[model samples]
Target chain A: MLELHQISKHYQPGGQLIEALKPISLTIKAGEYLAITGTSGSGKSTLMNILGLLDLPSRGDYLLDGVAISSMNDQQLSQIRSEKIGFVFQSFHLLNHKTALENVMLPQTFGTVPLSDIRQRATHLLQQVGLAERIQHKPAELSGGQRQRVAIARALMNQPKVLLADEPTGNLDSQTTLEVMALLEALNQQGQTLILVTHEPEIARRARRCLVLRDGEVVSDHLQRCTDPTQF
Target chain B: MTAQAKFYYLHNHLRSCLNELRSHALRSMLTTLGIVIAVAGVISIVAITEGMNHSLVKNFSQLGTETMMVRQNIFKAMNNDVLQPMTEREWFALQNLQTGISAVAAFSRVELPGTGVSGVRISYAGRSQIGRLLATSANLPQMTGRYPIDGRYFADSDSDARRRVCLVSEELAATLNLQLGANKPLLQIGNFQLQVIGIMPGGNRDILGTSADVYLPLGFAMQLNPKDIALEFGFRSLDESNTEHIKRQVNQLLRQIQGTRPNETANFVIENATELKQFQTDTLGTIRTVLLLVIAISLIVGCIGIMNVMLASVSERTREIGLLRAIGASQSYIQSLVLTEAAILTTVGALAGILLGLGIATIIAAGIPQIEQVILPPAAVVLTVCCAILVGIACGALPARKAALLSPITALNLE
Candidate 1:
């Protein structure tokens, strides 16, 4: 489980104070499929960044699995991120120079795993994501959906309990988006907690819970069936 | 982390660094140019310096290590201070001492009395060229191993009688068609004429030099101008091991003959060929030190150049660095990645520079060669490359630190 107690982000450009995220408290239980939907500049990206531990909150506290994140140093934060959190960006942020298998093996490079095991596990993850035949393709060589699939495989390389995806299907065509969403849903069904950041209502309708944010504040937090949110 | 995990991490970092270079080959080459030039400079300078040392040692070998050059006012040669000259009687007394020395020659440099021309003119069958005049004793060949190889040396009788006869080395003989035991054998030195009784067989190569030489007796040299002939003595011992003893004996005899008080510093200097060789070696060593300092400075500049490029590379890869941070790469990992890239660039440059420098050195050595051929010492090449690697690490440090210090969010937002 992940928990936030009134976590908010503030920054200043030159001398003007800007509140990017307002004080809000929230929590998500284990194995929950959560969608955070917001328009442009609705602080959804900022919230995802804080959830992934990419940035520290200007105020408030964050705890994951009952361990306080506010007091950890950068290196300790990195260890926790590697061991407990997985991040998937909208651009599919796979290193352009590496092949699919190499990208999948990257997270383990920073871990305490032996090389031989990392290789085997990377190969198995690619297979689990239906990319066994495309393991050698670089990002440029793969289709949009295939690249997103590789990113998903790489994210699952360390087997993190919490997966944070910021618009995983944002760059794909509609048909490929369905395939990527299906893969994500399958991983969620297997009990990995999934947190998706998107602005599309149709995509948010598939989540077990939806949180709509506006003007740096959470406007709505409600549970929904797999297909009920389009009727909102 | 465990050692195995560290190795695994290093392996991946090395692979990615190499991949980064492969993707941007031209930029890598440009960044490494300074290292290439630096390594090449060091290697070639060392090669030539080593080559010159070999030739000087060879020359010293031919000089015969036991040989000594005795000169007055040698220590104060830079000044015009007057010294007590060795009289003819004193030279004979030192030569008769039955000391460690086997052969010795006292030479006097003189010009023709009326004409100021330093060399004498010889005309045989209308072939006229200026030849050097050396006033020497009969043991000319034994003193320095430069003797007449073709004809004959000066006999003691010729020096005793103060004969107006002279011997010409073959190097001078070829110019005038001079011969031994000819019906007509005479050359003109100014208005005074002398008969050429013998031809001296000459060595093609001499330690100092082999030139057109006309040998005259000491009596004949005194006949030119006894007052102005600057005198210098040279001697060689049968046993090189007893040179110090011979030098002491010569000094004592000279002091007794010149009548200097016991406590006064002797004005003459005795320099042996081995000592000269050591001096040459020391001089060359000094030159090598100075050159190495200059090369080290240039290499430092090369290091700074690499640092500048590393800074540029780190700033350019901001987004990638952030991604690595987000993916849980530690600060040390990012730092190592940057350093690894710099090290790879410098290694490639240094290797290429070694080849280029050695190739150029080989061409130079081939063009100008000594009796003993020379090549670069392998240890120097190895050390230079190791120095390059060290410089490369220093060059990458600042940039790697800068990259490691960037906040993951700030870096990810950098365009």
Candidate 2:
């Protein structure tokens, strides 16, 4: 469960104040599949960063499971991010020098998890993402779809409570997009909380609920029907 | 975390750092060159100084730590009217002192050709040679703490009786084909015929001009220039511990004999083997300090080179830093990673430098026979290594801070 009260973010570049996100309040319960859709200037990515705890809202009183995020320090926030939230970036962001398995094990490196357990779980997660045969391959050696799958498995390494994906299929082909969507759909069916940020309407429709933003403000929130078949 | 987990954490970081450096081997080597040179320079300097100190100690030990020598201060003698020539009475007074002086000998010299120029003409059998000449008391060997190499030293009776007996250096004896036997070989010096009583060890000339090729009785030499040459005294203390005490007592006695007041500076200078060694050590210490300072400046430059490379690395790895931060690495963790990389780089450089430095020192020592046993002092090695690591850490600080302070979102946004 997560809640945001009057959250707003602003930036100053070259002595000019620019409002990246206007004050808005929102909440998402556990196990909800949600998508945020917006145009180029919309605050979708900013909102996703705030939700993932990667960036702080300039004026916000964010609550995660009734705990105020504002009261926590950087170290505490980092710990919460490692344990409770996982991110899937559009570019994959996998370390090019490491194998897919090492990339998947990256999150647990900062924790007290034993090396053996971390290796074992990363291998299992890679298998779950249908990357079992390609665990040893580096990101540069994998196809775009396979790289994205590796990123997905890495995001799941810590068994985070909320999975936040930012344009997960932005670089994949249409066929690979279907497979990724089916994977997300199956995860959502298993009571996993999912939050996605995308500009594509069809991709946004796959989620059970969608929010559209215009000019740093949410304009609409509605439930959607997923008509695509799960062939993955 | 458990201790085992902590170990694994550190082990992983170390491995990661090694991997990163290996990937950029050329850059790493280039970055370490400054450190290598700085460390090598310091090591070589230390080795050379230590070798010089060792030889100096050996020379002083040969003269004996307990030995004391008194010489007229030429500057004081010229400037002050109170300077008085030491007489036989003063010599008797010094020998009578109860200040643990074991033996005392009085001697003086005049350059045979007068100031600056040296050497005296001598003849033996049918050969003639030029050599340095000195006049000394019969117990000069005991007072100066150096014994003859081949034969016995002259006796006090010989000095008191004005016997025409003398010692010749091994070099002079060898040149004249003289050998010690039942019948002592006689040599002609000026207007006297003196028997060779002993052979002194041959060596380089000393500051006191005592290592002459030929020595004559003080009693006989004083007869040559009774009013022109001032006598210099050498005293042997009972042991090293008594030298300082005897020296002060003798200084007072000399002042008393001159009738100079207690507050007035003495016209004579008192020197001991111990003081000579201390002066030598102090001089060497100053030289070492200056050399180390020059090396330190070079080391700082080397560290700056390291810092420059680290700054570039921080910028190049900005995205990686962000990813690590986003994945739950603390800012301090990122800082430590960069610092560790720098430390490892300098450590490698230091090791290589130690090898190179020892090699350089060995080559230099081999070239100089005086410092034949050069050993690297352990303190110098420890000091240089510790300095390298500390400098490495200091150089890494700025770049590590830069990397740690980067905002994760901004870093992630970079392509």
Candidate 3:
């Protein structure tokens, strides 16, 4: 349910032109899991930022659910981000001062949901991610795996249609990484669209389809089926 | 937004800040130091002014509500320090005037040494108490707005017939160990027996402090002390209006009677209670101005301190503001949040200062006997609160603007 038509993004530093994303075109249907794999400086992160509506394209048309978002103001873009897209960062960007439950409830603040219901839903999501006992613990008190779980629960708080995880398990150990992958796979199997950016081949193999990007352009788009999606 | 929602938001934000403040209680107290000092200074000055105003009103009221004084003045051509005396003819002319003249009386002094005139004896209580006897007309009670409480005063016939009747003050009676009442026997002063009519209550004993006074008939005083050339005349007017006119006319008539030129300076001066009241008002005004200046300086210092603290707080909360914005908080929300914190701090400080100031004033007023009571003027209280609110808004402006202008991405990048 996302489309990008000839999107081009550039940056200038010290009067030198630097291309972050070259002209590119892509489309993803509803309820499909996709992976954008690339090395450092390959523009995958920049594409993810543009896809999430966190940044605007220098020149392009971004149609999200069939509405052109390039003409939307910052406020309208933010509203769409809050209502339609959930983001999971590699660093797990949970507010250091807030408990796991509060971090998960952060996105719900923009909606009309009652605080008590938000708390209950956040508690339930944390329990689903095997963090029921650690829901009240702040990020500083949690392990690497537990912090990522809190981020994942937070990304699902508003029940967004698309879950965008930018290297969600990049900082976790292999076993914790497998658990995070399994959690994401289970959500995707339930018909929620998932898009992840990663450089790890084994991690990329877990997605239903993998798209390789290099030098600010997509080099390949291939479909993959793992022997066991729950294992690394 | 609904009021309840707004209240919930504000309450949570304030509670969070308060918890932080409680964690650093000593620092918070230090931050509030400027506010406390300013409030205390304001209170003290206001209290002093209130106390002075109270005392002034009391003294004036004691002088009587509808009392005015009239006296003769000599015309001065170049020098203003000339003194002049009024003649008997001029005094009679004033007494006959139909304008605001209430009662007219002339005064002369006499000294009597040793022994009692009637039943009351004479004794010296202090140096000034001895050889100070006032000889005035029988209408002295009406002119001075004072009357005997225990014994009779001299009658008009006593002055007309030049009788040697006299009245003694409570201090003189007490010194002689005599009881003074309406039926009490006449007091003896210098071999003259004067009947005791009444006793006058001494209101401010320290100011009109001593009570050792004696009153006698003016004509009898003239007869007893013929060579005493220093004679002072007093005129009591009906009210405040005709006092100036009566004074001018009396001065002119006195100049004509004494055969002095209009341009020539008089040898006597005219004085009144009005001059004393004016002096009191000027003194009060000067004191109020000085106090207001001090309060203003303190308030400025307090405002500066508030601004400094708010700026520091804004800088510290930059990342938190960014996080809120990233989570969908509007820019106005961030601005309002910072402004709310500022308003809360300043309002609390100001309220604390007002209470502190009033407390100090009450304590000082309680300790001083002359003050009677200390009252805060409504206008002063209103002004103080308004100044405090304005200071809060002014101090919050820069920090609030900075918070509102911060970009969400840049703010999130703040470490």
Candidate 4:
């Protein structure tokens, strides 16, 4: 579960304040599948950054399970990032020097997780993501679709409650995109909190609910019908 | 808190370091060269100096830790300079039941008659040779704490009755071609016949197989070569540690007995091999310090080179650092990654250098016959290695700090 109370972001260019996001409040309960769609300057990234606890909101507070995120220190924020929140980047941000299994096991290396259990857990996660046969392949060796699957497995390393995806299929071809979207759809249906930020309308329609942002504010927040957009 | 957990963390970080090192092996080796030279220099210097110290200490101790030789400044006495040897009255008090002194003997040397610098000549049957005569008291060997090699030393009766007896070094006996083991072989020295009572052991191995100087009773020697000279008093202490105390006491006695002014240096000089060894040690210490200074400077320069390489490595991996931070690694963890990598590099260099240094030291020791043995003290080796690692850690600190402060947002915003 997550809550944003009057959260906004702004950047200072020399002397004047440039508003990247206007004040807004929102909440998403556990297991909610939501998509945030916006143009380039629609504050989608700004909002996602606030939601993921990567960047602090300029004003007001962000709450995750009734706890204020802005009040905690950097170390605690990192702990939450590792434990409760999983991020899927558009670039599939897998370290090139590591194998598929090693990338999946990266998160636990920072914590008190025992080394003996890391391999087994990572292997199971890789298998769950349908990457059982390619667990040893590095990012350079993997196909676009397989690399995205590995990224998804890595995000789930700590069994994060909320999956934050920023344009998760932006770099993939149409075929790879369909497979990745299906995987995310199946995960959301299984009650994983999936918040996807994207620009594609058809991709956004796959979620149970969709929100469209114009300028820096959310303009639409409604349930997506199966016929809302033509399926790929 | 648990041993397993601590071991796991150590293993993880060390492996990470090794992995990173493997990725940049050439750079690591280049960076490691400095520490290598430093360790090698230190090890070789320590080994050589320690070896020299070992031999010198043995030589000085062999002179008998308890023995003290008092004479007119022997070096100055040779140059016909100042100071005169003890008189009968002065020698009487020292030899008569002195507290710290176990035994006292007076010895002196004089030119052989008509031989000049060719040295004292002696004959035995058909054999004849030139050698120096060491005129000493009957208890000379006992006072000096070195017994004769084959036969008995001159007895007190030999000195009292002024009997003609001699102790020849093994080399001298060989040169004389006389079977000393036979019934009292006689050696004719300066128109008088002397029985070879003892054969002194072969000392000064460089000249061991050749003829050496012969020892004779002081009274007999005085009668045979009557050249007026001073008496050189040699005494042994009851215990080894009492040499210095006894020497100090003897100095006061000599000053009083010779009736010298308090402002004047003693007419007699006390010669102790330990003192010479100590002086040599002090001089060696200074040389060692200078050598260490050179070693330290080299190590620092090498450390700087390593630091420079680490800084370059940190900047090169800025993007990876940001990604690591984003993934959940703390600033401290990121710092350790850089520091550990640097540490691993220098530690490897140090080990290589130690091996190199030991090899060089062993080769050097083999080349020098005077060095009895060369060994690297274990404590010194351990300390050298530890110092190298600490230097590596110090060099890594700034780069690690710079890396740790990198912001995670840079992963996306900056290449």
Candidate 5:
């Protein structure tokens, strides 16, 4: 579960104030598939960053699993991010120097997890994503779809409760996008909450709930029917 | 972290960096060149200072343990030109003077015919040999700490009988090819037929590389060679204390014997062991300071080299650092990694420098005729190594800090 109250993020560009995220409020329950969609410069990425705890809100309180994280230190924020949330990027930012398996094991190094256990979990996640044969390949050696799969495996390394995908299919072909979307759907079915950020209507269509933003404020919230809420 | 865990972390960091360095072997070797030159500079300077110190101590020890030279005036030249020699009256006055006066000896120079070298033409036959020949009472040996290496020195009986027996230096005996048991009497010079009684050990050679000459009994020397009058005087003391006081008293006594005016400058000089030691220490100190300055310049150049290479390494590993930081490595961890690389490089270089320095020192010391042994003090080696390590750490600080401060997001984006 996550809640944002009166969230706002402002920046000074060329000495003029620009509000990246206007005052807004939102909430999502556990095991839900949500998508935040907007056009370029519409603050969807800013909202996503705030949700991921990668950036601080200018004026807001963020409650994640009932703990207020607005005033926490950087180290504490990092700890919560490591333990409670996992991130996937559009670029599939897998470390170029590491193999797929090592990239998956990266997040585990930040937590108290045993190295052997982390390795085992990463291997299983890679297998679940149909990348078992490609675990030893570096990001440059893998296809876009395969690299996204490795990124997904890395996000799950600490067994975080929420998976945040920021334009996960932005760099992939249509077929690879469908494959990555299917993998996200399968992960949602396994009871992990998924927050997908995208600009494409087709990508947002896959989510059970869609929140649309125009400028920096939420414009619409819609819920759709899927086979099962638990399956998403 | 626990010490063991910290050690493990350091070990892993060093191992990874070393592996990377090995992959870029030429770059790594170039990086280490600076450290090598810096450490070598330190080692060479220290070795030279040690050599000079050794020579000073050896020469000082050879010049009698507690001896003090008392002449007419503090400012006078060693070779007296104006002052009269110490006569019997002045010696009697010195015998009664307090303040630890031990024994007095009168020194002069002379020349003689070459003994047992038949048909061999000698150069400068009319000129004085200018050998330091001492004329003293039987107590001269006790005062000077000089003992015969063969045969014997003059006895009290010899002094009383005014016998003309002579003691030569080992070098002088070797020069004249005079064997210890040879039946020939020592060559006659003036009225005395000086029998060769003994040979003294070779000491600090003069500028011409010649050892000191023969000794003769005071009574016999004064009686046989009255006109060979270029005299230099010495006084051995019972203890080093009161040497200054005795020197003053002896100066006053000399002035009284010479019957000079109160402010008239005397011809002879008075030199104390403390002054000699101070002179030696100051000379060595100056040499050491100059050497250290040169070493410092080399170390600075070495540090500059280290900085240049480290900056290049930082650029090469920019993406690697970003990856680590993204994966939760703290800035401190990145800094530690770079610093560890520097320490390892310098430590290895220091070890090499010490061995090389000692090897060179050994060779130089072995080849020199004066040095009997070459000793590499452990302190010198330790100091040099520490200096090198400190240089590494100092040179690494800025680069490590720069690496640590790199933004993970930007670094991750760098190709």
Candidate 6:
């Protein structure tokens, strides 16, 4: 479970204080698939960064599995992020020089996993992302969809508690986007908690819960049933 | 992680460092050039220094280790108000000393009557050459460990009888086209004709050097120049083990004869073969230190080059740093990774430098026949490698710190 009690974020650029995210309360139970939808300057990216533990909230407390994230030191925060959060970025962010399997094993390189088990788990995750045969292929050699799958495999390498996808298909073709979305849906159906941030309403509608934001304020928070039965 | 696991990760860090270099081969090679030159210079200098030391020891062994030279301390006499010259009186005092010496001889550089040039002119068989004239006693053969390769050395009878017999070096004999033994020719030395009795060994490689081309009986030469008072004394100890005792006894006798008071320093100096070798070794050590200083400067320049390249690498790989951080890498891990890259760069350079240095040393040794062997001192090699690695680590600190302190979000957002 994740809880954000009136969490807000602001930044100062050349003396002007701009609020990137307003104080907004939110909660999501385990295995919940939530999508945050917003247009440009809508603070969705800021909220996703805060949720991923990449940025700290300026006001309010964030609790993940009953541990206060705001009071933790940088090292402790990194440990929590490594163990509890996995991120799929718009750019994939896979090391281009590394093979798909190496990219997947990157997360565990800094963890306590034994060397032999690291390779085994990375291979299994890569296979689950439908990249079994392409494990040795580098990022440049793989298609956009394959690279994103490698990123997803890497994010799941440590068996993180929550998966955060921020416009994960932004650089992919529509066909590849559908494939990635279906993979996400499948993972969600398997009781994996997923958080997706996208401006596309169609993409947002596929999630079990939708939260829309405008001008740094949350405009709507509701649960929805997907129209596509295949993605259920 | 456990200690063993951390060690394994260090291996991974080195592997990644090497991989990074492999990807940017040209840049890495350029960055390491300074280190290569510095290590090569260091190695070659040490090799040559070792070779010279080996040669010095060999030359000392070839000469008599028991031989000791007694002469006026020129630097000390210069500072004193009255310059005390070592004359025959001091020589007589040394001869009467109770130390166990094998032979005692007095020598001086004699100037011919009309030849004022430093060396005396000698003509034999119509070939004329300038020869250095040495006036030494019959004990010269025992003191120098050098005997005539072709005739007999002067005898005490020759000195007692005041005969004008002289010895010519084998080098001068060959140049003058003179035959030795029964039909030996006489050398002309400034209005006096002396019979050449012996031909000593030639070649300047001797410890005392083959600078003296001609030698005459000391008493006979002194009688010819009775006014020349600055004479040097030399003696051979009974054995190599007795040389130090003989030196001390001789020093005490000379100080007493010269009337040097109890608190005053000795005006004369007594030198044995060991002290001479140590002086040469110390001079070589000074040269080695100077050479190492130059190489150290080059190493510092190399370090700066490595630092510059690492900074560029950090800047170029900002996003990579963020990605690693996001995955789970600690800041210390990132710092160590960058440092490993620099270390690998310098290590490669040092290895290449060692090969090049040995090659250069071998070439130099081959060119110079005096150098007995090309020596690769293990300590110097180890020191060079250590120096290079330390330079890498020193230069990597700033750039590594810069990379480690970068915000992961800001770094990941860089396009």
Report the C-alpha lDDT of model 5 over B1-415, residue by residue, as the tens digit. Answer: 6776565555555555676566677877788887776676667656755765676676567566466655444335444445455565666677677668665665544333333211112212242232445566666556555678888878878977988787877766666666667673454444445787888777323211112467777677667556653455556777676676777877787777778788877655566655756765797799878877887887788889888899888987887777556445667767877887888788888888777766776676544434434556789888877877887889889999999888665675575
* Candidate 5 structure lDDT: 0.72
Instruction: Give Cα distance to truth, residue B302, candidate 2, Å.
Output: 1.0
Instruction: State the iRMSD of every prediction, in order shown.
Output: 2.0, 1.8, 3.8, 1.8, 4.3, 2.2
Summarize candidate 2's per-residue lDDT along B1-415 as a digit string, tens digits. 7898888787667766787788789999999999999899889878877887887766676787777788776666677555777777678888899767877888776344332344677778877777767787777776655689989888778878888888888878888888899999999877679999899986424444466778877777677767755778887778676666778899889888888787776767888877867876898899989989998899989999999999998999988888888877888878988998899899889988998988898788755534635678888788778877888899999999999999999999899
Q: Where does model 2 exceed 4 Å of error?
A: A14-16, A226-232, B1-5, B65-283
What lDDT tens digits, residue by residue, belong to model 6 across residues B1-415?
7898877666556656777788889999999898888888888888988987887887788666676777767777677556677777887777877568865778877786665543678899789887778788787777676788888889878987899899988878888888785766788888888999888886323334323778888778878886764678777777677777777778778888889889876777788877878877898899999998988888788788889989999999999999888766768878988887888788889989998988898887755534657798788788778877888889889999999999888998899
Alpha-carbon shift of residue B385 in model 6 (angstroms): 3.2
lDDT of 1 by residue, B137-200 (tens): 7876677665666556777788888888777777678877777664648788777777877666
Q: Tell me the deviation in Å of residue A41 in model 4.
A: 3.2
B332 Cα displacement, candidate 5 (Å): 4.5
In the range A135-210, model 5's lDDT, one tens digit per residue, is 8998899999999999998888777878989899999999999999999999899899999999888788789998
Tell how far residue A70 is off in model 5, in angstroms.
Answer: 2.0
Task: Give candidate 5 regions above 4 Å deviation.
Answer: A98-102, A108-144, A225-232, B1-29, B51-63, B66-281, B304-323, B331-407, B413-415
Q: Output the lDDT of residue B160, model 6.
A: 78
Better of 1 and 3 by DockQ: 1
| Model 6 regions lying over 4 Å from their true place | A225-232, B1-4, B61-279
- CAPRI verdict (incorrect, acceptable, medium, high) for model 1: acceptable
lDDT of 6 by residue, A1-232 (tens): 8999999999999999999999999998999999988887999999998998888999999999789999887788888888988989999998887889888988877655566788899899999999899999999999999999999998998788999999988999999999999998899999889999998778888888988889899988877743432321
Can you tell me the DockQ of model 1? 0.35
Task: Tell me how each candidate scores on DockQ against the true complex.
Answer: 0.35, 0.33, 0.12, 0.27, 0.10, 0.25
Ranking by DockQ: 1, 2, 4, 6, 3, 5
- For B1-415, candidate 4 gives per-residue lDDT tens digits of 5887777777777766787788788888999999999999999989988877876766565566666767665555566666656655677778874677866777766556565454667888888877666677777666645687778988878977898788887766787776666689889877778888888875222100112367777677666655554677767777777677888888888788888889866678786666656766887798889999999999999999999999998888877777677667777888888888888888889999999998889888765545656768999889988988899899999999999888777655564
Candidate 5 TM-score over all chains jointly: 0.61
Residue pairs in collision within model 4: none
- Candidate number achieving the greatest DockQ relative to the actual structure: 1
